[model samples]
Target: MLLIVGAGFAGLSAALRARHLGVAVTVVAGRERAFDAPECLSLEGVRALHDCGLDARQLQLPPVREYISRWGESPMLSRAPPPGIPKNIMLGRVQLLRALRACATEEGVTFVEADELYRVLPTRQGLQLQFTGPVQELVLDASFAIDASGRAAVLARKLGVGRRTFDHLVAYGVRGPVHGLPEGVVHTFSVADGWVFAVSDSPGQAHVCFYTNGRLAGRVTEAKIMERVPYQIRSLMSDEDMWLASGVSAANASTSLLDVPGGTYWLACGDALQTVDPLSSSGITTALQQGAAAVSAAVASLSGNLEPMRAYWLESRAHFDSYVRNRNSFYGFGESAS
Candidate 1:
């Protein structure tokens, strides 16, 4: 039996693949909703979608481009926005979860809701999982445990896996309606505190986020952040327009910078292995791709051939490193936001 934690894109993908391989897979997801990606484009913009193999024809929205900012020392305008994306191409967190649930159920994967895993013990006969929920605490036995628990890295942290944090910058986001904006024109601007993003969800809905230092964090009032958008549009939004995961949500109506740690799992596929910046909009693309990657590794590991798993981990690490480098370079104004 295989036990997987979390049910985001990566977790769901892993469960689906494992079940297809005839393995008994069970998933434990904390919440049913996956946060929707902002309609906004990243500095590298949307063209990266093509690189990730997202089918453009399936989305019929027109492309929007504009002059954004340069990050590095050069004082010049950065031209050429990411390729414009069709509104239909983007899937909200709720829709993604529903789709994954359907796929996992059809594939015969066992899924449990609101169950939190507290412990994992790898024994001679397989692995044992201790979980707690509304019902009661239960123990599950499996041959292997895949920690798709994401940034929590519950299993990995317990096993002494270290983490690396990037520079001082935090991010907060709110999604709602906005008008009179180009579909593909995602704007990244610098303020006295840090950077702010204006992302479009559709013709009317938009996602606005601000990144500020810890000291300046307290001032990002919900009202001010909303005001960052057009006045007429701001009036149409409410506080609940934002979706914040625990620990990352703002309470004083301010934005916070979080530690950007490039994490890997002791064992597993998907986000448990690595996570990219939402700024790159590669979350879903990579989650789907990594799900396949994890399945390949898990099969190899099970067959006593660990080489494939190791290779997969190496490739994941290399790709994320490139991503970090690309982001730093873009912020420094060296490369086009590719």
Candidate 2:
């Protein structure tokens, strides 16, 4: 049996994939609520969901038709999907999580909710996990364990794996009702300090955020956020709209091949493995892809083949490096243009 931790896209995807392969899999989702900004599903992400038997349209996700981007003080530029490419979709983060949970349940994945992972013990055969909260004192064992715990890198940290964080990148944002943004369009505006991305998930409701250095984000006030955004977006902000703010380091990379793959009965996937820049808009896609790969690695490990795990680690690292290079190029272009 495989034990997958965390039930966001990565965990759910891994569970479903393992079950599809006839492996007994259980998911421990450590949180009850999924609180996040709206997510934009790239074309690859949409295809991945469909392959997993999930229909975003049936889930009532809003279609995103174009992107309007402005670098620094430059004029805004509009970009539509290229010919023959699939248009992206946008949906509230929590809504998407709920839909994914429902899909996983329908596919016979067992879910255990816990507030914390108290301990993890390595066994001769596999690993034992202890959970807290309603599952207090309960211990579960599995042939293989997967960590999909996002940027917290829950299992990785517990295993004493060092994390390399991109200190230069940080993001702060709020979600609330806003006006002036056209429905189905995502807007990104770069500023001297950082960049702002806003997308309307539903009529009159949008998630707006700023990506900047961690220090700058820490010092940024609500007033400063308003000033950084485009005038059209700034005009829409008002005291009446309740806004919630949160911040995090947006780019994190790990040498997973060196640090993760050689485990006898453990693997790490999704944001626990690496985090992408929001400007890349590939978080969900990366999570889903790695989740599926992790399952394959687990299955191969069960059969006494360690090559798959090594391969997956290498692939994940390469993907992360490529993303970092591209991110630097993108930010560099914005800087040079400014």
Candidate 3:
């Protein structure tokens, strides 16, 4: 049996994939994760869901029709996918998890309701998991445990694993009533000092967020973060009012990674393993891919394959390196809108 420590995109993905691989999986619903963040599922992400046997249309996802982007004095550009690249879609984090959880239940994946993990005791055969929720105390043992609890890294932290923080990047966001942008349109633009990303969250609603070093969030303002954006862009999104909404919030957008992603009997996947900038616009996809990748290595090793876990780690690192190069090149225009 295998235990996964989250119910977010990655944990749920791992659970679904485990079932597909004929492995029994139990998901620990550790402290609830906030699912209000806005996300855009890339073409790659759509395929990942397809590989997991999920249908986004049935999940009520809005397919993106176009993307408008501009950066650092560059001309405003409306670009189309090249060749076979499929279109990306705007995704609601909450809606995605709800769909994943529904599928997991239908597939008979056992879910242990718990507030957070209490204690982890190591035994000869495997790991003993403990948790105390508002309802009761519970314990379970598994041959392996996965920390897919997103940024919390619950199980990893309990295992005494350490993480390395490379920077304090964060996204300050606002979601509420707004009008003007057509449904299924995703927009991003870089100003003289920063960048702004906006999506039509739903009918009569919009979500806007900006990335910057967390150390400077206190002095952030609409003008500094959204300056010099063309009227063409401004006409599409009237973001000036979002700043006054008490609904304003902040989410960690830091670029960090675990010092050690796994051990002989456990591993961390998704954000618990590595977190990239939201500017990449592929957070959900990365989590889903990591979950499946981690489990693939686990299954191969279980079948007497040679050190597949190490091989998986190397592949993961290489992916991160590639992501960094792309992100740096895009950000080369200027520092974050902070």
Best by lDDT: 3
C-alpha RMSD values across all candidates: 6.8, 4.4, 4.1
Give the alpha carbon lDDT tens digit for every residue of 1-338 in model 2: 69998998899889889878988889988766666677777889977787677887888766786777656453222232124433557777788778888888988999887777778889989989887867356688988999998877777677777766654455666667776776787887766666678887777877777666665555776556556654555655553335534232233222232255336688888888877766667889888888988999889979988888989888987887776665545444442212
lDDT of each: 0.56, 0.72, 0.74
lDDT winner, 1 or 3:
3
| Deviating ranges (above 4 Å) for candidate 1 | 36-88, 182-192, 213-215, 218-266, 333-338
Runs of candidate 3 with Cα error greater than 4 angstroms are 31-33, 73-86, 218-243, 303-306, 333-338
Better of 1 and 3 by TM-score: 3
TM-score of each: 0.71, 0.86, 0.86
After superposition, the stretches of candidate 2 with alpha carbons farther than 4 Å from their true spots are 73-87, 228-233, 236-262, 333-338
TM-score ranking from best candidate downward: 3, 2, 1
Q: How close is candidate 1 to the true structure, as a TM-score?
A: 0.71
Candidate 3: TM-score?
0.86
Over the stretch 187-305, how does candidate 1's per-residue lDDT look in tens digits? 66554445556656467666666665544455666455434433333433443344321213431222111122222223644555665554555656666667656765776777788
Displacement of residue 102 (Cα, Å) in model 2 is: 1.3
What's the ranking of the predictions by lDDT, best on top? 3, 2, 1
Model 3 per-residue lDDT at 223: 48
Candidate 3: global Cα-lDDT? 0.74
